[model samples]
Target: MVALHRFVVLTTTLLLTSLAWGETSNPYLPRARLLLEELRYAEAARALDQARAQPGNARDTLLEILELQGVVAGMLQQPAKARTAFQTLLVLAPDYRLKGDYAPRVVTPFFEAKGWVGDKGAALRLEALPTSGADNLLTVQVKPDVLNLGRSVRFHQREAGAGWSEQEQPLTEGKASVARKATRVEWWAELLDERRAVLTSLGSDTSPLGALAPGAISATPAPLPAPAPVSPLPGKQPQVARAPGLPLRTVAYVSLGLAVGAGATGGFLGVRSNQDRARVVGAPVDEAGLTVGLTQREAFALDARARSQARWANILFGVAGAAAIAGGTLWVLGAPVNVSATPAGVVVGGAFP
Candidate 1:
């Protein structure tokens, strides 16, 4: 029984990890492409929707989704949607052009959308400017000034890997501040019309502008001073002194290993509890309509065990998640780390020797 449970735990962990990786790898994009090739535009559109909904899609994946959405909308005679899609694509890639041969119906709307953006001039263009004489404060400016349009600018800001928060200000002011405590900030600005409809956006949720807080620097540990060379007595060798304290990287690895073990144990218990529940529910009934495979007392006992195991499984899962987060944080903050600032966000790299 113990061996079987261990096997189930390992199998469950692998299955869950693979499923998560599959989602991140995007199974819908190729399916959508196939559907599009088959001229099943509606099905293709649905697949594109699924692709858009899936998190962690890369920039190329987003561009493809917009491209397909525009084409699918045009094929379905949804000119407004097609125009909107094309316009968004154009905003992301100003010089983007239709690559493949397309019908006039599909081609016309795209050019019209291009013309619309061209006429807007700098109305859609936004810039984030550091506030003068203010720490951690940023002011947004719209080219050609959008205050006359009676629109509002909404700023979305967050620390890396954190949930976004919105701050809406009149287009006239364009005042928003970054969190002073944040080491790295990701932000985007959206122009909203009177009805809160987004007319144009500076950055998107998937792609945001990243900025490091002023005076915030990556913590790099200083090298330790070498110990004085001890003069060895005749025929005696001096031993090298070991560094004190446990390595942060080793602690991180241990935490991660514990997290995986706990998660697997939880998954196995959950599966076992579900099986027990199924047995209790599907037990054979005798001619008297009473459960025969499991006695009434046995059914009650099994139900209680299932519930108890489920509760413990949930607790273990929670612990696993917390441990995983702690491990990842430690890994990122460990010494000998390299922090690279990119337009999208800050990337931290480290390794144990």
Candidate 2:
């Protein structure tokens, strides 16, 4: 029973540690499905991806899976697969659209235009170079905004390219890729019109300032972004270097353990000494009356003195042991044993032998 309980505890502790590292991938199904119903198809698909990770977590009937899959396929513009997936979803979740709010009808193609900048997912903002004009090649500047990367010119006009959607300008897209890797991308907007275009740049971090030219077509970028600050988690104390050796904590705990051992030893010795003295076998110094021969009263007095001295020694050992153990534990736990300022944060970590 004891061992079984210990096993359970160990498993739970490991599970908790994993959770701390990342959220467990379950319970995302319903939410993902709801997102799909609400037309948040992309996000829903991503959610379902996470949910599908756990083994045997696919409790949904195969038909239900097919249904959601179909919706996702359609939303992603995979018509062939969409047809198949919808067939499944319809069979399994017949009243999905009925149960939840859904769009009344389809509109013009949503994928009419598309672009990405920076990372794959970062959308490039587009605008018809109204200010620049079709006769003009709008020059977009790229800057390295990453911390410590510097404020130097990473790229400039002609660094980024303009073109139609891949479907329309596959050749241009191919050409644009030639130099993309060299620059820090800021935005990617459509140059469809001489005045207005779509932007796929700066991502969520950037301001959604449309083309400098007016008669803009977009609603305010769906959501304005919050200001960018330095590191997010704050007040996390800096760490420091320690004297070369085991972590101070390690030294501390080991010392404490030794001290505890010493304390125990000392206490045992003290009691033994007292017992010996009482028996007169190893009484401390003879008492005052015992000049020539020792008397029982003198022996007893000497024993008591010895015992008192031993007691003090044991108490000292106990205190030292405690300090060592405490110090060692802290070091092992990775707490800064010798925290001090470096600049923004103290640097810890060094070779240990």
Candidate 3:
């Protein structure tokens, strides 16, 4: 009787121990919920595995499992996994929402997944503006939200019969921009996954660039080459008269001189400003003990003068630098020189008009 009683007590203790361990560590649905509530995402995910192992879970139980799994995956920054879980949940329950105030970060992925799965979610739009003028750059903008944060949207140009080929630019962060030779082709965009499969399309902008023939660009025609010099008609010396259009060398030299002068002046002004600052700093210390150094009014005047001179010096330097560069480029390349002759004389000129 004593032995039997002892055996019963031992079994009871063992059973209680097992139950307590299961409550703390087993990945049951209830335990997973508790883990998730405590923000133990990894533990909750592990608990979810246990729940998943059980076959034929109720529809409500499955919904809860998927929602919790998505939440945990999102919290762990596993977007793909979170998206998968949410999509599966959407398949089961078309209208499912988490109870209480969850973060937008976690909730956003759910909505994105919902949009991907069904038609009852947020809508995304694409807007593209092709730049006018000489540059062949295209600017694509997307709204109102980027579906996938880091994934790129492939820009595609449609060909006549060969279908669509990816364009040069990839849109990321809801914007796409690139400089390329413009063509008479239709362009569109698509969001793609890692496998290069199209997830969804961001649509296209079909603004016509006028009715120009394919491969034709509108550009000013080149001026006809100047008539070759006529063979000298026996004995009349060529009377060459040159028309000067702002001598490039002269302009370059003058601009360079001004630049050098302005730079020197700026440097001098900077030194003076530094000197004034030093004086202002020292003035306070020297004047600390009853009557000494610069007066407050004098220090203020010096500071103001220093700032004004510095500002003017910077402006002069910038203007001088720009002028020098422009003039120097013209001088190096040399402008088109045109020459024409009348019966009385020959005239040499720069640019026709």
Per TM-score, the best of the predicted structures is: 1
Per residue, candidate 1 scores C-alpha lDDT tens digits across 82-185 of: 88888877665555766556654466566556545555652346677863443776567765542333267778888867898888777665443434436577
Candidate 3, position 161, lDDT = 42
Best by lDDT: 1
lDDT of 3 at 52: 61
TM-score of 3: 0.28
- Model 1 pairs in collision: none
What ranking of all candidate models by lDDT puts the best one first?
A: 1, 3, 2
lDDT of 2 at 138: 27
Answer with 2 or 3, whichever has the higher TM-score: 3
What tens-digit string does per-residue lDDT give for candidate 3 at 95-213? 57665345433555565575564443434445666566665655666554433521445676543444556653455666776543335545666544343333345454453222223
RMSD of each: 25.2, 31.6, 21.5
Of the pair 1 and 3, which is ahead by TM-score? 1
Candidate 2 — what's its lDDT? Answer: 0.40
- Model 2 lowest lDDT segment of ten: 106-115
> Is candidate 1 or 2 superior in TM-score?
1
